[model samples]
Target: MASTLTRLGAGILSKFGRSVASPTRLQSRPYYLYSPEPFHPIPDKQPLCMTADEAVTVVTSGMRIFVHGCAATPIPLLDALARYGKEAKLHNVELIHIHTEGPGILAQPEYDGIFRCNNLFIGANCREAVNAGRADFTPIFLSEIPNLFRRKIWQLDIALIQVSPPDNHGFCTLGPSVDCTRAAIQNAKYIIALVNPNMPRTFGDGVIHMSHCDVVVTGTDPLPVISQHCCSEEEEQIGRLISENLVQDGATLQMGIGSIPDAVLSKLYGHRDLGVHSEMFSDGIIDLVNKGAITNAKKTIQTGKIVSSFAFGSKKLYNFMNNNPSVVFNDVAFVNNTAVICQNPKVTALNSCIEIDLTGQVISDSIGTKMYSGVGGQVDFIRGAALGLDGLGKPILAMQSQTHKGSSKIVPFLKQGGGVVTTRAHVHYLVTEYGIAYMFGKNLRQRAYELIKIAHPKHRECLEKAAFDRLKVMPCP
Candidate 1:
């Protein structure tokens, strides 16, 4: 201990005060002990700043670049890249990111081979491009994305990120996004950051020193904001079924963004001490915090803090995260780890799917052969909750009984080429506006009966007939 402290730089020793520093893990918190308090390390030198156009000048053809994603997307840099690419006639400049929000021109026909996008998870901005074959999507678990960069599988030449201004000690936070961007910086040859004062300074594994940036672009662009989703009557009914029946007090939650998620969270105000350990979150959680429903007191890990990899929401939600100690943003790799997720009690992973077959096969990422979205972190949290520490976890899949076109979502067979994001074995609880179905340990015939019970009333007869044909036994409900 004496030798380790002797090796410590005077700056860290002085700033850290009485906090013990372990040599094995030289961070704000020791390996054995961790708190949600924000920490900053002093830097010996500050990095120089440059204009957005000048920063992209380092890009050469055939270089793969990683763009920061979610609400933390660097809008100005991306816009500048598009302009500079056309001007310089740059070709084969591959861009990688997950669910970014900005000018969607990179994948347009005009840019074409100049700037090609490879989305780890498709968002609205690039969905059309991916489907059109102008852009590409990689279907992988969100938890393993970091390995793609770190292990040099998808070697990155440059990393573009958005961050808050450097603190007094010259440390800037990665703002709302940490996930794979952190790993990108760790391995990328060049690191470019857009310093946006409007980006919220969040805590957890996102802090970086300005000295680490190869080039910095200063901008004050406001982060993109998504308004709250209003739930439909059917969505509201689905929410009530999950919230009232499955969501218990002291449960840890993992959910995505949508009317179904919004509906579920809307009804969680009556619960007590509910915890959040999700890959990402949106404005829906803000109300639960306001209503005193999400106190995080009952969580066995990271007690008293809402844990997430990133967030995307309205200005109100961003304000709630700025320098807020109660919220701890972490790396998506750790946040979605089944081992970490199952450490908590009653982890309810509330999710939605595009469709489900009678035998419990789920299709979420595609409509038949055409890709609609990338496979996100659904399987991670689903398996995590299925193995919850206290033995009462719920892995639930919820959706409306019928598609927007009035077709039954519960079918006897998945679409001819539909991608199954979650398989039959991983499934446990399935919810719909009509009711809930528990599928764990059930045979094919039994699972079909439960699913038909919760399917739309108009489609039940057809589903029943289809089930008997498939199961070779009468599926009576």
Candidate 2:
């Protein structure tokens, strides 16, 4: 202990008024100390158990609360929080987080008078609120989320989380979601955890000792289930084209979750020595992993391991990751770091967006003045894929050329106030159902012409008129 403290850099120790040095594992309270074997829950309950109502009292009015994200969300606890908010006018309590699954009860119109979500990442659960202007959005990188908590910028008043039942050693697991929960749990003033039995005992920086938890609520509710959306014919064709373009035996890959990503993964059945180090993964990657396609043999960073921060899919995906060693679920800060992603050669990032302007301004989060999704790790992987000092690399952004209502997705200009999630400088390749368009180093007029060629045939004439009107050129620049 003395030597460890002496070796401290003094900056962390002085700022936090505590030791910055890491203590010996045996000396420090081991998060998993009571475990005679892994996967075994504690035999007896401790003294900190409380009813749902009692737990809700901790959250006062006008407070800033952080909820656990992804599969680790505590649904019962959030329901209780909503109940309390209804009973006691808990107005102005700001809700902050990335996309959390399940029905966003707090974001509904009934609770609009009390809870105002400042969503950092808009998910389907909170889409209506954002589109209706009842909630707000923040466009930022996922890697920088922890800094907000550590620097006391957000100043979280309470953190609501869910975890696996404690092991024999009195340490609980953070389960499927660890992205920003570790930082939130460490920095919040009061921490309330719902100790659930069904939460997967995931490995990583997700363990918490019994002493660190201020309140524990025993619950038996099942974790939220994620449904897989199927790929359309257009997506399948685009996926085939995208897959055909890839060179056999390429090392690294990064892809966001969706039908197109699944389609692309399905197309890579015959490819050899592929790897995955993505922000998230779906059931598509599972089949590839089973077939030995994703051996992680060619990856430069975290070699020989499938890496991701979180995952959402059917029961098959959850069951596969339950006790799997091949998948290493780390935090978003590490998984989505551009520098780390760039280290892996032939990094291909497959991302989706709502619209792309003629000049290559990608907007994935909104529908023309309506906010849809938050900026969540698209630019991180895109820029990382573009860091091809090797000269043979290309960063690809994939999206359908048209929306479901037959509206054009490739626009002459972004809708006013639409966020430019990806800048023109970072864009390289754009793929749609029609074909692929290379926009790197192209002038404004050439870029417009190439993108229009990929736009849906029904919208092409109108798009051409808009492009020529904007650029003031006869045909196109």
Candidate 3:
């Protein structure tokens, strides 16, 4: 097996070298394929059921632990661990993750002395802790996080996971959360699971046999539900306009969580042969898939597969994916690579932004100097769409024209100290409720004009003044 992997790696390296030497063939050779599946799961002897307290007891002082990501968070176990933080006097137990759902008591100030958060991706629950200096972040590509574990770079001591009840064959699915859990389970010295019948049994490389869990916490809790926030009339209009621009039979689609994405999906019922290759999805795409709009029929990569790293939605979405071959839950490392993403022809990566400057710098992860979301798979799929073959397509940055407070999102400059999640050069299409601005090769002045045209009428004059002041362009007085 090692010899085979080595040879495969060498072949990939050689191909990469050839691509660097010749750019034309690079486009032709770009396609996605999976490595052969690993053998059926190897089960350990005698899997024991235990309470949440018993499950967390394996974690000791100064140990590094990985928590399950997205909706499949082991909430009962994590809350129990927080309670254990007091009883066991567990000090310096570090919790690392991209994002998790639930109370996240471990991130509270009371547990600061006992637990430290090393966030790979910051979500709202841990945002305060991260900003308060109780936590720190590791800025790495989503595609490389699993490698950190596989290479023993992070050295996981324990993993807290939630899984479905064992099937007839004794294999348990990772449920709705599979992004980093596979790596955590493989790398951790000990694995503890919360087994809930309520958790859906998902398909793909997201399973482990009952015997593999060192200790299992049998708990009954409804899987957490995340419904789509309603899309405003303006958002719906934006979505409709963007959908109108889509090719009649585009083959691949990549969308993230939020109203804009939900809005976009809401308008795609008429389109055909749509495919999904995204980091995560919510309730919006269910109708499309059910209506046979998303057939995944024409995709060159993962053909006929709904490929994603994680999922967040109501129980309905969960039920649909349970044991469903239509969905393949893989690691972020594999799902978010730009090279793999563009293989599906007409890949339209519709991502959101916190705000965008006139010059097209996207500040999606931060507000001014403070961190909000992390540097996710945005750039990965964006570049993938831009470089896709046959002049096929480009990524879309979608957002509303104005903030809830009526402030414009399109500005002459990003807020001071804000991080640029997407560079100016990479932005291809910027869409708002008003219209789309194609700024792929536009100069700074031209970008400013295009962006301002879509800015809310209330803020247009202000932005124009700012741009004029900064660029020394004569204002139309």
Q: Which candidate is the best by lDDT?
A: 1
The true-versus-predicted C-alpha distance at residue 397 of model 3, in Å, is 0.5
Off by over 4 Å in 1: 1-45
lDDT tens digits, residues 18-48, model 3? 2322213212111112321221444224344
Per-residue lDDT of candidate 2, residues 208-263 (tens digit)? 75546656777887777767577899999889878888535665778877888888
TM per prediction: 0.91, 0.87, 0.89
Candidate 3: segments with Cα more than 4 A from true spot = 1-44, 474-477
TM-score: which candidate is best?
Answer: 1
Off by over 4 Å in 2: 1-47, 388-393, 474-477
How would the candidate models be sorted by TM-score, starting from the highest? 1, 3, 2
**Candidate rank order under lDDT:** 1, 3, 2
RMSD of each: 8.2, 8.5, 11.3
Q: TM-score of predicted model 3? A: 0.89
Clashes of each: 0, 4, 0
| Residue-by-residue lDDT tens digits, candidate 1, 105-223 | 78788999899999999888898889899999999999999999767798787889998877665678998888878887776766778988899999999998766665677788889
- Candidate 3, residue 433: the lDDT equals 84
